[model samples]
Target: MAADVKTHLYEWSTTEGSNLPVGSTVVSTNLDDNLRMIQAVVRYLASSGTVASDTTTDIGAVDATFLAVSGTTTITGLGTVSAGVYKFLIFDSALTLTYNATSLRLPGNANITTATGDVALFLSLGSGNWNCLHYLRKSGSPVTAGSFSGLTAAIATNTIANGDYNQNWTWTKTTATKPALFIGETTASSATDAVILELTTAAASTASAAASQSAHFAGICNRRIRRRQGVFGRRLLVVRYAD
Candidate 1:
C-alpha cells in the first residue's frame, strides 16, 4: 500500500509576536513522504584534480564529479578517501581510474577504468568499501558533452577539461533569472562549501494568493509575507529556483 498525503489550507497570520496590518494569501505544504533510496542524494561537484595527470583524491560523501585528465596517458592514484555515494563521470580522455584503498574498498576489490565522458554511480560503505550502483559507457565511444536544448537557458555545447569552461557558460535567455544551486568548480562538495554558489540577489517579495488561486501555481510565487504599513501593496510574482 502507498502512503496517503494529507493536505490543508494555509493562511498568513502574525509571525511571532508581531502582527501584520494587512492580510496575506499564502499556503505551504508539509511533506511526509518516504524515499527508498539506499544512498543519500548529494550535490553535483567537480573532481579534486585530474586523474591521469595527477594522483586523484576523492573524499567520502554523497556527491558528483567529472573525470578530467590531460597531459598524461595513465593514472596515478585516487589518494585518501571520501567515503559516500558519488556520481563520477568522465569529461577528459586517456584518464584511468586509480584509488588507494588502504583505508577504503571497492566492489570486486579492484580498480575501475573509464573512457572520456563515461558516467558511473557508486556508493561507499565507509572505510574504503565502495559498490558501483550504475554506470553508462560504450566501447571505444567517448561521450563528450555537446549542445543540449532541454532547459530554457542553453548551457552552450562545449567539452569539459580543456580548462575553458568559463567561456562556454552562455545562457540562451536573458529575461529569466535562475538561481544557481550548485557550481562544480573545484574538487569540493556542497558539504565542504567548496563549490556552493552564493545567493547575492535579494529575493523578490510579493503578496499572497487568494483561496481561489491558492491551489494553482504561477499564482503567488515565492512571495514572502511581511507585515508592512503603507499605501503600496504587493503583487503576485513567479519565482524560479535552480540547483
Candidate 2:
C-alpha cells in the first residue's frame, strides 16, 4: 500500500504476511523508512514555511506538523482527514476559519475570524473530517463573547460605568409610561465593578452602582421610591429589574 505523505506511515498490503524472508530488499527498505518516520515524529515540531491556506488545505504535501498560514481565505478542511492525524496551525494574517459539524469543527461551532499570532490545534476523525482541539488567540481572549474592561463612570449608549450597589438611578414616568430592565454581564477575571450594561429600551433610565472601586451589583433588585406630584402629595411605585 502507498505510504501516507504527511506522516510517511507505510501501510502493509492485506496479503502481505509478517515473519517473511530477510532476502527481500523491499521489506528492509520499508523497515528503514518506518524508522525514519518514527524519528521525524519524535522530533515533535516540524515547521512549514509561511504559506497561504485555501478552502481545502493541502498540508499532506508538506512533511510538517506545524504550519504558519497566511491569506484571508476561509479554510474548510485540512489535509485528507485521516484519523489520529494532528496539525497545529499558526495564523500569520487575518483569515476566516470555517466551522462545520463534521468536516471541520471549531471550538464554538462558529466561524473564527483569525488574527495574526492565533494558533489552533486540530485532530482528524477520518471520513474527511477534522475537529479543533484547542484554539488560542494572541489577544488572550476567545472569540465566543464580546467583552470590555475598565468601564468608566460615563453613561452613554450601551456603556456601563463603575459603581457600587447602593447607587440609585431614578426615572420620571407618567401613568401610561413603562420602565425597561437593563442587564449587565461580567467575567470572573474582570474587576468587581467592571460591567457591560445592556439597556432594553432607549428611554430606560440609568443608575450608578456604588462608590468604591470594588463595589458591584449582581442579580435582580427592586426599589420603591416616591415621585412628587404637582405640589402637595407624592406617589410611590416599585422599580424592579426583570429576570
Top-lDDT structure, candidate number? 2
- Model 1 stretches with alpha carbons more than 4 Å out: 1-53, 59-83, 98-113, 140-243
Give per-residue CA lDDT, model 2, range 1-243, as digits (tens): 322223542122223443232344364436666566556755645555555789888654455678899788888877574477677889998988888897889887899999999998888677778888999999887668643445566476674454454545455655443444444444343564332432232244464322234243432235433343443233222234344
Per-residue lDDT of 233 in model 2: 32
lDDT of each: 0.40, 0.63
lDDT tens readout by residue for model 1, 1-243: 221221110111225333222234122221122121111221134434344444544433213354444544444333333344454544465455544454323334455566655565555454545555555675543333444445574478864443323343544644544532334445534553121322222246353343242354553366553433233233332223432
Candidate 2 yields a Cα-based lDDT of: 0.63
Clashes of each: 10, 3
TM-score between candidate 1 and the true structure: 0.27
TM-score (all chains, Cα) for each model: 0.27, 0.51
Cα deviation of 165, candidate 2, in Å: 23
Residue 75 of model 1 has an lDDT of: 42
